[model samples]
Target: MHSQDKLIMIYGANGYTGRLIVDHALEKGLKPIVAGRNKEQVKQIAEEKGLPARVFDLDSVEQVANNLNDIAVVIHCAGPFSATAKPMMEACIKSKTHYTDITGEIVVFELGQSYDAQAKEAGVVICPGVGFDVIPTDCLASQLKDKLPDATHLKLGFDSGSSMSPGTAKTSVEGLAQGGKIRENGKIIQVPLAFKTKTIDFGNGEKNAMTIPWGDVSTAYYSTGIPNIEVYIPISPKGAKKIKRLNAFKWLLGTKLVQNFLKKQAGKSRGPNEQQREKLKTYVWGEVRNDKGAWVTGHFETANGYELTYLGAVAVAEHLLANEIEGGAFTPSKLVDNKLVERLPGTGEIHFKPE
Candidate 1:
């Protein structure tokens, strides 16, 4: 199925990352329907881009399914996906439309996995974290697993040189409210923010990194069957201390009042400009260790976060549309492979070694 043969809709097409995905899809010669809950905003964006529009919220599964009529796939970009993934996923399964999203939330990834049976039953593929959230890390983890098939523990880290979009900032706020997480012995468990810190060489010299509730904490487990996993991001010592301090106020941060206020502030900030997106880069590092203390390490480089999201999300949707992949939930690397990510625009060669 080519672009003209199948209709794809981009929900949340008015948001910053959503807009980037729309542009990428258009550049690939696809006429995707732009959609979101705000009728006026969605319509305005669609009109400006000269694309069709559909306005619907995830409040009701029936309503959402109705809006998805005749759409072959949906690139669900609206996030803080902890709140949106379940409903949108249910609607997608109900409507028998393939579902993909740019979510990096562990809860959302698990939520998608929970619907694997339903998605398979309905013959609809459900894939999330098709963006900067987990693509690079997921691919890294998969590669490490390939290098060390008996790996028992997996660690992934990333350093991105781009600014966050409003949606990503809001998602960061949501993540902060939830504290930190990691997968151990095949189960997810909560911990304090910045619970662990270390130095990692993500293609560059060593940098300080701290553990966060990155999507790979959940996705890498599924992608590589690694029973233990931890994901980290670059952070300064001061930043780590600040996050550690917030652990005492986790209750306040999780409160609706505080969350709403913080999200509002995050929403007001504009993301990276075109020049910034072009100039910045992202690096991913992964290591897998076995009971015998054997290990393998890998590193990858790619475009900036939002730029990778646009390229990765559109590419995943196009692949789903053109192929008859199995009907089930998947991580980005699990759905395709590391090669798919390696082939994206601005992706660099991957390096791996055993030690």
Candidate 2:
């Protein structure tokens, strides 16, 4: 369906990424209804953008469900999704409305998956991690599996400019507070924050990446039937060293005080500003190996990951509006066609090498 006739609601529409999604949605000719707990903020945004706005408090499930009626889909952009996802998913399923979000929280993802049967029963699709946090890696893993039928081990890496938004920084802090995980020996294993580090070359240059708990650990396993998967994000050597040292005090991760302290520190240490966000580029690299002593490596470069996230969210909205998606909880890799990667707005240069 074209965006013009669809009634799409953007929850948390006042946040940095949420505002970008709203702007992109409007540019695509969609009139998005911005919603969040902050009615004043959302109202101000709507008034400025000439869009509609609503107030949605997660504490009130009935109100959320009431608001979901007649909406084509709800794009839940407010995160640390661990707290928001379950209630939102329940509301969508009850209202028989499609739902999508940019959440990369593994705990949130697992909780969403638990509602798959309910969503299917209600004929409502629940798709999560429809953003750079996992979509590229998830889609790439699916593509690699299609190429190598027997591929069993998956390693995905990416390096991008440091110009991250406030929401991204908050998400990173949340991830640091909650340690990451990786699939090893065909089983899921908890990993200390910044447990593993390696250098990844993105054709243009090389950068060091540390293991981060990416949502793909949940998505790729079911999508590609791969038991072992890991995702890494390249960081500066100095940052890597600092992370390594911090990881030694693993007990600190369990305390909310420590998490808040780190969050404050991250906010204080500015990386890139708005101009840098416009100029920054992102490069992704993936390697798939099997037990047969064969391996395949692929590289892709695109605009900044945040921009990709906005486009991906819009793509998801389009799919839901058109009824192109099946009713169930799914990751982007499982719900969308690999070919749609071409339709997605961005220049993705992909190359594969054999080893």
**Candidate that scores best on lDDT:** 1
Clash count, one per candidate: 0, 0
How many angstroms is residue 54 displaced in model 2 relative to the true structure, after the best TM-score fit? 0.7
Model 2 worst lDDT window (10 residues): 266-275
The superposed Cα distance between candidate 2 and the true structure at residue 163, in angstroms, equals 2.6
After superposing all C-alphas onto the true structure, candidate 2 shows an RMSD in angstroms of: 2.5
| lDDT tens per residue, model 1, 272-297 | 99999998888889899999999989
Best-matching candidate per TM-score: 1
Query: Looking at model 1, which ten-residue stretch has the lowest summed lDDT?
Result: 1-10
Estimated TM-score for each candidate: 0.97, 0.92
Residue 109, candidate 1: C-alpha displacement in angstroms: 0.3
Q: Look at candidate 1 and give me any clashing residue pairs.
A: none
lDDT of 2 by residue, 276-335 (tens): 766777777888888997888888876677777888999888777876555888878678
Off by over 4 Å in 2: 1-5, 236-238, 265-274
